[model samples]
Target: MTMSAHGRPLRGLADLRTLTGRSDTQIPAHKAYLRISFLELEKARRMQEIRTANDRFAVVNARFREIDAEIADILASLNGTAPRAHALEAPHRSAVGLRPVKRQFQISY
Candidate 1:
């Protein structure tokens, strides 16, 4: 391969042919065409990857919103019942086996 003074491979078509050892004159044209097609394929692959990532992000974001709404509903229910829960008294129990058992519920804010 022909190298420039800076030690980089030469960019000329003659240099390309010499590096590849191709006696055929059409190698440069064919290589250029194939390179363009390969670049197009790479571009498509990158776009698909981006699309997949975006779809996953959207799904995860939706799930988070759903969980947040569920949490809000649970909090609202707890707050709503807090006052009524405190006003309710424990139920009286009948004797079982020998002695009566009383059940108590602890309420904490």
Candidate 2:
């Protein structure tokens, strides 16, 4: 089965139903309340999905940084420079890297 961004498979309906407190219930719930509860559950699911994606992104970004540092170390050795002790130090150390982008909106008649 395919895995989710959270490193686990998507939860089955039983798991979702359990979270919604409807898994073991025998009596039927009102249609209106059921609909509202489902909507809220969906919202929670979406939030979890976004959180998982962000977590995955963070892991991938960290791996990329490690790879980049290793490559830089190799390049330094090739150039006959001193072996970089702190090879993982960011290139733009203590630099403000963020710049605001100005957007122009044009309206045509």
Candidate 3:
């Protein structure tokens, strides 16, 4: 027997009809099974999408790190110093030893 993603035996509408013999009592059960199967399929698709998005994010992050290294090399050359490769090894730190600064303004009444 073939199993569905929801762990139920795979059955077509015709198979369900033939098995249930159009009995009213069994109709609801079949409907419930179909609904659950649909929900499980949708959840699996969404989980795959999330996994793809995470992979893309990781690739973009790696490229950004490469760009940071290139910038550091350029800056070091400009400053007449050898690039300090160790300085940029910290994952949380960027090419420059500075964090983004936020400014606040005061409003006058």
Candidate 4:
């Protein structure tokens, strides 16, 4: 069931007949193959979609961590001797802080 890069498309039994030249004898096999190939191709497409989404998420997570670290360093440098309340307003706040997060974890709504 190998396909050429620019091979003829078998849109249906008639199209398959034109491409293979001996369509009558192989009609049953061709029909079965069409069904199986369509299903298999669909499954593979879905798997690829999932892999792409996973890669995107990984990129997002890495970016988020990078931004978080950069902001933490900036905060530590700017307010080393400031009062706790002033520093609390920074993004890299204490463990219980509620600073607004950066757009490093964004998706289009």
The candidate scoring highest on TM-score is: 1
Better of 1 and 2 by TM-score: 1
For residues 1-109, write the lDDT of model 1, one tens digit per residue: 6667999755775544344554775668879999999999999999999999999999999999999999999998898666454566788876666755586777989
User: Comparing candidate 1 with candidate 3, which one achieves the higher lDDT?
Assistant: 1
Off by more than 4 A, model 4: 1-29, 82-109
User: Which pairs of residues clash in candidate 3, taking residues 3 or more apart in a chain or in different chains?
Assistant: none
Q: For every model shown, what is its TM-score relative to the native structure?
A: 0.50, 0.44, 0.48, 0.46
Pairs that clash in candidate 2: none
Model number with the top lDDT: 1
lDDT of 1 at 87: 66
Tens-digit lDDT string for candidate 3 (4-36): 789977677666445444446555887899999
lDDT of each: 0.83, 0.82, 0.82, 0.82
What value does the lDDT take at residue 12 in candidate 3?
73
lDDT score for residue 7 of model 3: 95
lDDT of 1: 0.83
What is the per-residue lDDT of model 2 for residues 17-44, given as tens digits with 9 covering 90 to 100?
Answer: 4345446545456876898899999999
Q: lDDT tens string, model 4, 1-109?
A: 8776789654665544344445465558878999999999999999999999999999999999999999999888987776566444546646666768766876887
Q: What is the C-alpha local distance difference test score of candidate 4?
A: 0.82
Query: In candidate 4, where is summed lDDT lowest over 10 consecutive residues?
Result: 14-23
Task: Predict model 2's lDDT versus the native.
Answer: 0.82
Worst 10 residues of 3 by lDDT: 16-25
